[model samples]
Target: MVKLDNVDRGILHELQLDARNRTAQEIADKVDVSASTVRNRIAELEGDGVIEGYHPKIDYEKADLPLQIMFVCTAPPTERSEMVDQILDIRGVVDVRETLTGRRNLYVEAVGTSTTDTVRISDSMHAMGLSIESSEILRQRQVQPFNHFFFTDPYADGDDNGED
Candidate 1:
């Protein structure tokens, strides 16, 4: 595991808020370090795979992709891989996760311009011999980093609480 000093943690916290606005010099100023030090630390973090590539959070509505849906799919044991592959081929699919549920073990997140497009993608999944047990539109107002929030000291060796 990568070891993050306080400065590194501060840099990450700042970047998470506004990835595009800060430069190494600015980050150094905030963390009270040299610009080169900040740059080197960031590079080291990136090299260690602790810091992934930066990304722009695009507003889907502005991008003409407003509708969002989640699909819970179930497939025959033998056709699971094929069904997953077919679902990934759908145009609007953004994410797919293999869940642990008997009725529907696959969760798919997709975005499209309209409900019709979302339905078309669902229909295509049906045509691929995949059974969609349940589907729903996801209205996400706020998203938070639950893992980070809950597990602040991820490397702690002892039991998190005495309750366990």
Candidate 2:
């Protein structure tokens, strides 16, 4: 694990705000660092695994897959990895989150054109010997940005002085 300093946090903040099409030089200007420095820091972050790959935020409404279904699956501990791989192969399944402290060990999310397809994905998982529960996602409300201030606040000290 690598520790990130204030500058590193600032760089990450700028990238998250516009990483889809921002250049390192652009991020550098915002973070008050040289362009090469920004680029190198980003490289270091990626190398250290702090920064994962970047991806686009798709508008599922216009992408033909409007129905979102979330699922919870409980399966044999030994078969967990295989179960996730099989679930990923299902047509409507989009993403999966593995868990550590819950009754269910797997959380799966899928998007489809209709509820029937989503249900079919769940049924298929059942046939694979995994117990599954699923729900329809009516809407995706929000994805809030990271609190860059929490990491970059200069006045912050070991003790809380005034601001809350």
Candidate 3:
């Protein structure tokens, strides 16, 4: 694993908040280092794949993609690859997950310019031999990183339900 010092961690934290705002000079000022040092550290982080490429967080409403759909699907064992390929071909699909649930084994998150686009994607999935268990338009009230839930323990040992 790549080891990060406190400075590196702080750099990452600040970048995560607003990747586009701070320059190497500003980051260096915040971290009390030379600008060249900050640039080199960022380069090192990128080279090590710690810092992936940056992206602009686009507002879907302003972008004309107001509809967001989550598709829950099940693929036949023989058609799994075909189903996945079809889903990847869809224009607006942002993310897809192979879920543990046997019935709705795949989950897809897609954004579209209209409800027609969402329905078209869903229909295409069904035509590709994937069973569409259910689909719903997602009205995102708030978005949180999945790592927040997965990395932290939300309950104590005493709160166990004794499933194991």
Candidate 4:
């Protein structure tokens, strides 16, 4: 496993907040490091697979495709990984998550312009032999960076970092 120091955690925290607009220099300033160091660290993180690709948060409704459906499905444990890969090739599918256990082990999210589009996506999943247990319309989703990534200096605030 990759061990992350405070500076590394700080870099990740700042990037998670806003990677699109935050430059290496800005992150370096937050982490109290040089700009070149931040750049090199980011590169190393990417190379080590610690930092995955940056994805933009899209507003599908604003784009005129308002329907976002979440499909809870089941697949054989052995086939789960392959099914996820194939499901990603389906049009309108935005996300897929695999759970560790239970009957509904696969969760797939798809966007569409209307019911017809969503139905088509459902049919495709069935063709792949996925037994869909439930499907729901997604209302909203909120995401934030992990709080532990934000290093709070105990001495800076004279609070012992919330220790008991």
Best candidate per lDDT, number? 4
Q: Using Cα atoms with residue i matched to residue i, what is each candidate's TM-score against the true structure? A: 0.68, 0.81, 0.71, 0.90
Query: What's the true lDDT of residue 121 in model 3?
Result: 89
lDDT tens per residue, model 4, 4-100: 8877887887788789998998888777899999999999889889998999999989999899999999999989988898999999999999998
Q: Put down candidate 3 lDDT per residue, 2-65, tens digits, no spaces.
A: 9887567657755765668878777776566888988888999999999988887767767888
Better of 3 and 4 by TM-score: 4
Residue 11, candidate 1: alpha-carbon lDDT: 70
Query: Could you give the candidate ranking by lDDT, starting with the highest?
Result: 4, 2, 1, 3
In candidate 1, residue 154 scores what lDDT? 30
TM-score of predicted model 2? 0.81
Residue 59 shift from truth in candidate 2, angstroms: 1.3
For all candidates in order, the CA lDDT equals: 0.74, 0.76, 0.73, 0.87
Off by over 4 Å in 3: 75-86, 98-105, 144-164
| Steric collisions counted per model | 0, 0, 0, 0
The alpha-carbon deviation from the true structure for residue 148 of candidate 2, after best TM-score superposition, in angstroms, is: 4.8
- Best-performing candidate as measured by TM-score: 4
Task: Give residue 159's lDDT in candidate 3 (0 to 100).
Answer: 30
What does candidate 4 score on TM? 0.90
